[model samples]
Target: MVLEDPSNPLVLRNYAQYLESKRDFSGAEEFYFRATQADPNDGEILSRYAKLVWELHGDQTRASGYFERAAKAAPEDSNVLAAYANFLWEIDANEEEEHSSNAQVDENAVLVDLPAKDFKEEKRPSSPPLHLAMGLGIGRMDLVGINQDYIISCPDDRTTLEEYYKRVVDENPCNPLFLRNYAHFLHQSKGDLHGAEEYYSRAILADPSDGQALSLYADIVWQRHHDKDRAVVYFERAAQATPETVFIPFGFSNVLASYAKFLWEVEDEEDAIEEAKNRMPVGQGTATAANA
Candidate 1:
């Protein structure tokens, strides 16, 4: 029987989002599946559910399906277009590494992203291709403004990342994302803590929900200015706004543990213990969390 209520889909979507935020992947997937079943024809539902499956289980086929559905649903959404393209690139890299045992393109090739125009109906492959330089292009472009968590951060890639981020910022100064992430890159890679602080301040002004930026900025201020009280405020804010990614709780716990150690070393055993206790019973996930 067809359900007549549109709110049904909305409730399922929100519940799924909550579970995902809580890092309950299986539970989230279950609800997403329910959402998909309840609204099979909904492009958003298909796309979202497909995304959840891939995100939770690393199921490429399923992920691709949903991403495709999402793209189809929102043909004009650059975000969806870019995400799907990047996924294609990942698929290619996996296959290449699996077969060739090495991907040292050295001078033989420069990465090239095949724009969507290249994927005409007659030329579609039996499966997704093993290369889509376009995906890296998409990542380079789309991720430039995004504030990735500390865990996924690859500081060594700062130069190229910075170039892209600068380009993005130049194109859209109002987009505080690139500026904020650039600040993180500076702090982490170049030790330009002051520069990072300025950028972070700007980002916070631009968007209150930029918790990663705010939290990291707080860490910098606390460590740089030796303001533990202020740092704790940021940490608490981050923990509050933080999503249930694979790394957030772990990141929070690690920082807390480090703060505790620092306090203990300084003979502030009370605060040290307090900090340690704060992160204890770490939410869930990761090897460290399991040990805790």
Candidate 2:
């Protein structure tokens, strides 16, 4: 019935989503392509299609074009900006030698492997990396990661990660997502647990329900601060927030898994660990939980 109106982009998109849910990638792509053709300027549709193609088919060339079109169509849309920025960042991060040097990278320079003009002719083998599929979705975190502050201070630039994060947090001092992501970045990249805690606390204050921030807060305090009481508080709070969260990506799940490991492995609370494992979606079981 939905396909009866082949010209209706909304129906097509919804049908595409249905097909996607059924694991029918070919059918989903067909409907999504039709929807995009009917409404070429729809940034949201373009973004969805871009992600769909990239994740299912590993067609980075097509995905990049769709992302570019989406950004051009809606230049001010935060979601579009976030996804595009993530795409660029992932491309850079995948490159082996991009960030090896201490010397400043030129402001005028761009990633040579991902030249804008060369995307049209790019090709790939049949088998794509499993990691790419595992890390497909873009969440609020991705949007937060692509702040102009992060972009302007390219990895090649002398501006330190701390400096870049400071600029972003300063730009929107009240934004919880920015604070949360910066905290994660600092913890992961700089190993600055103390600095991360400050930002994570600010993030929680700004929006107490952010499970990602709360989870990370629990992680650092438990791991580094050795504050079991404080850590448990945040962990419980994060678990409470999980059901209401939009989605929990693998990275977020990994953090939770770490906390769960701490409970079962480090803290030796098997009952609480089981409860934590049950909170996550099916298939995200805590079987892989390991020390950080």
Candidate 3:
């Protein structure tokens, strides 16, 4: 019989996921703790637990610790690193490659967002990979900052994360999911746009329809490499193929807007705006006709 509020870690984990899916990050984190204590070897719990820390507070260090656990648990899953690299880029911009320090990225740059991904539910397996891989290392990530001084004083702690992510890429080369994630991390953290471009390209070859690789590969080429022509092509492809995903729109839009801005500065304003509009309508067919 299911307990109304069972103390089982698995049950708590399910509840935590329910809270997270509802956008209640705080609730998820709290329950995730109860779950870890109940079952420290649960990989799914660790992944969500890590992501919860990242999303609610942008605590990359703690989040990274959790990611380590999650990664160890499900060595073949890309979703674990999917949020990590992106959130790492999102938080403390100065620490990421795009921004030299915590000041800003492209002083004139603004956030380019794509349409949100459609949410579809899927059934969970009784024993998922995430649940089995929670072997150990839960406490390390849970600590609120073993090095407080490093956090407040340092404007950029990119090195530590970069090393960690690099190791992830190197150690998990055999797993396509891990390889995809590692490629993604490099794209965001390595400070080598060309290298990032290569990794993302390889990831695409590994998984052609991978939304993460498609958009990130485009970002590296267009934004960092100044190749708007190729960037537009990839952005348009990513937009068309990955319309149903919430995150694709934002990444796709970033490329689109960047290309358009470049065009405006180069006296091709009309075509620039038209191209941006072309990919923005990808989800219209799937959405209700009224909204479309």
Best by TM-score: 2
In model 3, how large is the Cα lDDT of residue 269?
53
Candidates 1 and 3 compared: the better one by lDDT is 1
User: How far off is residue 159 in model 1, in Å?
Assistant: 9.1
lDDT of 2 by residue, 243-268 (tens): 42133343333434544555654435
lDDT of each: 0.58, 0.66, 0.55
Q: Deviation in angstroms for 199 in model 3?
A: 1.1
TM-score ranking of the models: 2, 1, 3
For every model shown, what is its TM-score relative to the native structure? 0.35, 0.40, 0.33
Q: Write the per-residue lDDT of candidate 1 for residues 1-292, one digit (tens) a residue.
A: 1145544867787788898899988888888778877666666667667776766688987787787666556543434444554555556556756767665555433335544455333242222111111122222232322232211123343434446555555665655566666676677666888988987887777777656666777777776887767766775565455442223222433433333333343346556767876777755335565698
For candidate 3, lDDT tens digit of each residue in 1-292? Answer: 1267567887898888888889887888899988877777666778778777877887868877776576456533445434444544454343444444555556334334322231111122133223112211111222223221111113344334345445545765544455545555455444666666776777777777755467667767766767767866775565454432233223433433433344344345556766766767786545645575
Worst 10 residues of 2 by lDDT: 128-137
**What ranges in model 1 sit over 4 Å off?**
1-163, 245-292
Overall local distance difference test of candidate 3: 0.55
Q: Name the candidate, 2 or 3, with the larger lDDT value.
A: 2
